[model samples]
Target: MSEKPVVRSSILPIPKSIGLVWLNIALALILAAIGLGVGFAQSGLAAQQVILYTVLMAATVFVLLNYVAVVFEARAEARAVASEEDQEAESSRLRQLWADNRVLAIAMATLLVLYLILTAAIPEFRSIKNLIGFLVLELILLFAFKISGYFAAGRSAFIGLIVLFALIVISAFSIEGFLSGPNIKAILLFAAFLGIASVGQTMVALLGGLDLSIPFVIGSSNIALLFLITLGVPSYVAFGFILVLGGIVGFLNGVMSYRLQGQALIVTLGTGFAVAGFTQIMTSIGSQFAGNVFGTVPGWLSNLAAMNGRFFGIPFPPTIFIWLAIAVILIVGLKTTTWGRNLYALGGNRRSARLIGISEFKYWVGCYVISGVFAALAGSLLLGWSGGAFIGVGDPYLFTTLAAVVIGGTSLLGGNGGYGFTVIGVLVLQVLTSFLLGIGLEYEWQQFIFGLLILPMVALYGRSPHIRATV
Candidate 1:
């Protein structure tokens, strides 16, 4: 057999040209040394002793690292032949990674086109503000790309943030109300909505599945609550029941898909259609609540979604805190909990998970149930924030939630991901959309641009259908 060549996996065409990642650390250290030197020179004996000890401790770290490098080098040389095999195997794995994520490259090229077009279109393109913004954005891109690899889950988030930051800087100088408090608050309120809804999508994506029923689930759940309140059910009781109803829908999805061994996407699609029909029925039943207008949602529900409220002198949507709370729970649970670990295991490799005694059925059921509950919760917020849902109330979220999930860096193929990263992605996307709208793009164009951006994350982060080659 001819010798096999190893293919390396890399999303970036030239990944290492990014920027000086350690620049901040180096500057901080230099500043610290100068400050300490100055202080130590003029300090009393006791203060001098403390400063000297701190410097010695920092110096020891460098010495220890050098010693470690020398020892590692000697050991590596001794294991040269074995190391070669490891490298070959690693290269093959990397090649597989690249194959799985090749779509990311297409996305990158597409975005570059978009950036160039936007640059020319921008009113301030030749202005100092534009030049300064692009310079800063380029530097950020360099640092982000340079450090990106197996360790980070928020590659797209970092990229999106840089792009948005550049826009903010440019717009602040040119646009009359660009960075004003109202505009910023408006952007954040929308982010609050998109980000909260994305939590469900992120959960489902982590299990390597998609939930198409979210729109209907959310719409129907909120409308159902209104319908129930009309029937004299207590508002709080209706809320709880609506939540459980959503979970029931998800459970059915899990059961039918698992038993039939059907594709999850198809199964969820079927459930979504069913829920959509149910929403229509609920709307018809609740039509009586509308005397002249459509419906009268509870005061408390409306209050939660109110954006004019001042919380501790900071004007923000009361519901924003709710998203923050959910984010904290998800981040902590996914990072530190046993169930969370098993979740990744199941998403990563179902067959291997089962071999280790992880109940595939139960975890799958749990993941969807969690998704359903959150979707229902989001529906209530949507109703309050948007002043109640109609046939298409959940329409916007279908794309926005998915976009946030993908951009947030949760793998669509399952396993590796978390909520904190997703939140950053949510803000990035919301900010991006806001900038596009500010630049006078129509709604369709705004959607089109974001829709375009979403493709890269899905293409790059997806991990499905493992492949191997031999010749």
Candidate 2:
């Protein structure tokens, strides 16, 4: 008798595409409900309550429906792939389509509809300028998501952008009460400086190195420049000297890191201490020099502590130009140069980079050098902004730069980031600090709140499945 043919079966769990989609929708709804409750409790417009509630409910339903539709379609395709005898062809086609444009199209459509409704229903948001600003911001965010592959990879970035947009809108309105023209200009200038300084730090961190010396470098340079200015050095000459000094310090950090071939953190920290000591010595020397001159220097240099100056009705103070220049140079260097690509390669995988004949030492030095230059630039900007720098001009930036770089989504483990993210990260941090100041929070409280806000974003950005797999 012929033996009965045996049949075997394998179990494979279907991807939870539907489940994920529903979960996101549910979370969004919960948030919407909470927002509605808060608005109802706080809003004093009795006449407009019905309209407000109706608009809120409509928005909730619309978002929920849109999410459900997209998810259902994706799930259906997934199911079809699972059931197919030759799954490869069907799955590949679906993935290709998904990757090309379906998700982006859906997202853009949703945002457009939401904006239209918000503008129509909320008179305050209907102003042409504000509407245009909103559109521009959304487009930028969309482009960011597209380039980063965040839209395709997972839902986290999509959610993040949405949350960020909400925060930006709130800030645009709420900031008016607290920010005078001068105050706004000051905040923007500071943010720009912080942005440029953090670029170098971010590049360093991207290469699996950290420079603790940045703050000291900046502080020393600023103090030196202040001393020069007090000695009647022309503004142009003093500025040129400050830039050179910053470059020298940066080059030194690079040399030290390259020669040592050890933990960058410890190396930079030691350098930082030495630099700090030098700064103190320089400050003392400057004070003595001024004393000996018997008050020949202009008193205005001492009295004008605030960097409060106007530029073309913008109130940009002197420091803004320095910050803008630094930003421009960094952006160009990183985005359009061979050195930038090599730096990324070295950071991503040093061994592979070596195999490919990339000079690890040279790129590593370059990273530190860049960091140094930015640090010095930051110092100079600080001095100019303050009208004259003090010994501690660079103190706050040490931690702030690190936080900004990490929060901007630059991998602390090295590789995988850009200056644009750094810019946003700086903005986010500055905005948080400004918000705290606006709310009249004490300095300590502001620091605490800022930390609280940043830590989550950093942790989220740093944790990665591929890195975990490697470990």
Task: Say which candidate scores most in TM-score.
Answer: 1
Off by over 4 Å in 1: 1-109, 115-139, 149-174, 285-293, 310-314, 456-471
Candidate 1 residue-wise lDDT, 359-433, digit = tens: 989988887887788778878777777665555667787777777776666667787566776887788777777
lDDT of 2: 0.64
What is candidate 2's lDDT per residue for 167-201, written digit by digit as tens?
A: 46555665565346666675776787787678678
Tell me each candidate's TM-score: 0.69, 0.62
Candidate 2: lDDT of 391? Answer: 58
Q: In order, what lDDT does every prediction score? A: 0.67, 0.64
